[model samples]
Target: MCFKCCLFLASLAFVYFAKAFGGAYMKSSITQIERRFDIPSSLIGVIDGSFEMGNLLVIAFVSYFGAKLHRPRLIGIGCVIMAAGSFLIALPHLLQGPYKYETSVSHNKDVNSTESILPCLSNHSMTEADDTPDLETKTACEKAAGSSMWIYVFLGNMLRGIGETPVMPLGVSYLDDFSREENTPFYLACIHTVGILGPMFGFMLGSYLAKIYVDIGSVDLDSITINYKDSRWVGAWWLGFIVTGTLILLSSIPFWFLPKTLPKQGQEQSESKSKSTELATVAEQENFLPEENQEQEEKEKPVTFQELAKDFIPSLKRLFRNSIFSLMILTYLVAVNGFIGMITFKPKYLEQIYGQSASKAIFLIGILNLPAVALGIITGGFVLKRFKLGVIGAARVSISASVGSFCLLAIQVFIRCENAEVAGLTVSYQGAPQVSYNPQTLLSQCNMGCSCSMKHWDPVCAYNGMTYTSPCLAGCQTSTGTGKEMVFHNCTCIGEMMTPGMNTSAVLGQCPRKSDCDRIFKIYMALSVVGSFISACGGTPGYIVLLRSIQQDLKSLALGMQTLIVRTLGGIPPPIYFGALIDRTCLKWGTKQCGGRGACRLYDADAFRMTFMGLITGLYFLANMLWGGLYIKIVKRQKKLALRNQAKENGQEGNGAVNGHANISIAKNKEDEERTGEESTI
Candidate 1:
């Protein structure tokens, strides 16, 4: 039953992820513009990045305030917004074709503008045979409708970004709220596992949406019945989205099923704010109070946001200054960046250079990634408990940075697969060099992009009874060595591309195959392994441990606010800064520019140098820093704060006790004086 609940949520997540999948499609369309519509690559990034346009502001505000508002509702909102974004992505395709009608507005006001300013597509390197968006050149059609259609699609996705931003944390919190009684490790594992499958299943299932068919006369996988678009695949994915969203929303109801009992994340804030307001009102009413009484009354005033922002003054005074927080944040930032970077290289580098289809390789990577993460998490859990560690110390920000960076180092080798494969294949053919994807024939079962159509076609590959004919060409390669003799190996994919022929798995052989089919199995594996491991070690564990640590610290709202400040810093884009450097140096490195794929792909020497070097440098900070460099400062600082706080409490109690003792002594002296006076009078 717990598994069912988890799977249900996973389905929902899968649906939500369709937006991401759709986003990938949108990128494909824009890339097509570069190839077909004659748009530039620069413009494509702009258009794609626009989907996440101003996401930082939204994500930050939403995450912070959403906690301050309501948890479940915010999650629901996130789902709605993400779905809308996914739907908007398909709008351009739906609107494609000649429109005879004109807009109702005078002066030609339309629903969308800037469509003609197309996001860039393919570069000039591709053979002219590649199909690109065909812009109607006839002047007569200018008045009918313009690129505004595509622009609408772009703008729609941009608007949807706001809604998509909150779904993750909010949903997790919602799950946390509901799963209060479940075992922590078991519950968390369920959530994490489902969360991944949600999006994946969404894409897989959504591909077959409502049996809807697209009628494009150009091509079909394997060239079988290629005249019409197939609806079954897309229908499945659409159904996935609706089903997942509906179920997630429904699952959330259980959290709200019983009457509200626990204090909401916001109640404490409201209470604190109210106290502050009362104190301010009283202070404003009078300029001064009697000296003896003033200190006593002032001590009762509630802490305010304004005063606390300055090094958390009152908290510091009370010895609530937590240095672990700082250490954790630093460690988390570096580790995540390096680790995410490492896995990303698989698809970006392997597929880009070697032209291997990403599906097969990425899948294998998952098998590897999952175990590593599970192991890491279990290991971390043990380490944390044994060390008497708090959440910040045990989980994220405190995470051993080396795991990620070292993993990245491992990632560097796989990227060479593309180069190795191309060199191996070409060299093997011409007697120059050799290569392999490690698990040879791994491509045999991979159907990712290698002609989804069961039928075999496309001259790029030919089919035997089971697999395709000829060696694999691998669309999104791991490597491409064009030196002395242009050696190539590793059939990144020896399978299929959705061509206008039949049995796409067949026919398309050995030639630069699996076109535009870079799956990045290695990246997926690394991410699955590393990302899961990190989350277990830091991400989920961090959330889980937060409550425990807060309890241990005996901090109320004051600590919470500091935490709020800490969390808000995450959305601040080092990515933009990273992007800035990429813009500066990526072009110099050659193909596979510093875009999404750039991180994963290791094509050129410069790209290799930049990415791997960055990986190494960042890793050094994450692991070593976590283990010793950063952690020492953290441990010391936490100890200091803890000691200081303990001392202050002791001092306050001691002062009160001393004052009581003095009052008692005075009473005894007065009684003695009265007794002596009575004796003298007698």
Candidate 2:
């Protein structure tokens, strides 16, 4: 039986890992998906929130009713559904044609040699129709209509959410039911610790896949002008989804063989001997009576739909009556809102604020940040188990960790890298670096001869370490070399900005940020790692608080309700609002093939940092405040429960003492009667 329990734990752990892998992979691909579909961040947020939407539809019923069924089989079914969703997400990539990036490059009649791209030489001024590629053909509009393929991704993610509904509430409740009370925290911690690895590998997979071009096999990589550093670059995002899908499919197999029910660990002897007293002792000590026991009690009476329906509302009422649970859920909800929003766009933040490539940002998160989180989670569990912390003790540890991390997180608002110095965006066209974007400052007398279209984002760096929007905008009359190796010569803007003797040529891609920025970036990452560890240290303990505070019989429904509430209020709205706000800081927006506005290519660094970090800090502040209230409620409730238990024990002792005295008095009377009879007989 213990062997079966161990098997279930191992299987559930792997399932946890698989599901986390899928979720993290989704988060990691945010920027890639955004660029690939030419969608805005706000739309990406909607897609991200679709998972919660799916959960919203069916979580309540599944959590409540599914607990009575075979949990492992349900979990297996969930895994299969998740796998299907993953595969569905990858379907759009195959269905769509090769990705096309907007470019200023054009070939000559011979097709081998490149033609001059000097718009300055043309007599006619360039118009929007001339620069817009998607509007050139009616056929392109038809293809653009298909660009709503993001809907498939949305639905797939939603399906994944629906599939994921059972895994947490049912699986966790099942484990808690069968495992020893002392062992539950460590077991949950082990599962979560293993689960954290999923995100690590998922993000690492994202990092590795991001370096490869999206259309790698079909097209020659040498022909592509931009590298992964380019904003327009779309990586192999679909490939990771397929890989994760396969892993999930494989993880489901072991769960199917697991039994529907298991005996409570460490109580098998009492259970086998059918000793009422021993069973009663174990039940009395536990906060929640396992579902198996409840089932055995009700097995003789066939349950009806009306009875089940009747109990539902009353069960919900009993759960929420505990003020501590309600406050804890609120605290968790606020914290999760910040967390989901922060994570969904964190890669983009690193890429934008720190001037890191998408691949590098994801890599750092996987290698540095996620491992810290894993460590912190295990540490929290070990601390709880090692210390054998009661409710009050657990609250102390959780609150301390949260408060410490919140303090560290607030410090992050001050640490930020300056915006990339670019012509027209972050600096004057004359090569003076500035802090804000001023589009009107893009045009100058030096490049006045060239009426370049500002629509396309083909960034090029001049010799003076200034980045122009494009070679045409840089006033480059000629270009040499091809692809990523290309260089622009006869650049009037560079010459005008630089001294006469200095070089006038520019090269492909934007200039790397200043050395100071690199130093600042390192500091930011170091703080991020430390802060993540601190924040995560409370995760296991905080979860334990939630698990222990609820009534045992309602554990599954309580967890499910918590998920529903958290996902609905916390998960659904953060990303949308966060993205919408972040959209306001855009310095440049990518143009879509359908002549519509697409993804944002650049953002004002200072405004972005303030907006993003400020929101997170504010949410954390509110969460911390709620945590304080929750702690007070927990302390008071525990004390009250302890006092009530003490009073009951004293009452029982008093009755036992009175009964003992009465028995002694009866024995004395019997002895006197026997002595009198002996005297008469003598």
Q: lDDT tens digits, residues 70-94, model 2?
A: 8899999999999999999999988
List residue ranges in candidate 1 displaced over 4 A: 1-55, 60-65, 97-160, 164-190, 199-327, 339-345, 353-355, 365-398, 401-415, 418-536, 541-630, 641-682
For model 2 the local lDDT of residue 122 reads 46
Model 2 root-mean-square deviation: 9.6
* lDDT of the candidates, in the order given: 0.37, 0.84
TM value for model 1: 0.50
Q: On residues 1-682, what C-alpha lDDT tens digit does candidate 1 reach at each position?
A: 3443454355434534444444333322332222211123334344445555635446544644454445555655665665565565555554544221110011122312222210011122322232222344333333233433556545655655655565554554444444432344344544454443433333233323323323333333222211112100111112232344344334333323222123222221233457778667456544554552375355346645454355334433432333344444455555555543333333333334444433323334344544455455455545544454453454433344345535555444443323322222222322234333232322233323432211112112223122221222232222222111112222334323233334323222233433322454345344445645554454444444333332222222323333333323322233233333433332111111111121111123334445544654555455555646544553443454444445456664235664465444444434332221111100
Clashes of each: 111, 0
TM-score of model 2 vs. true structure:
0.90
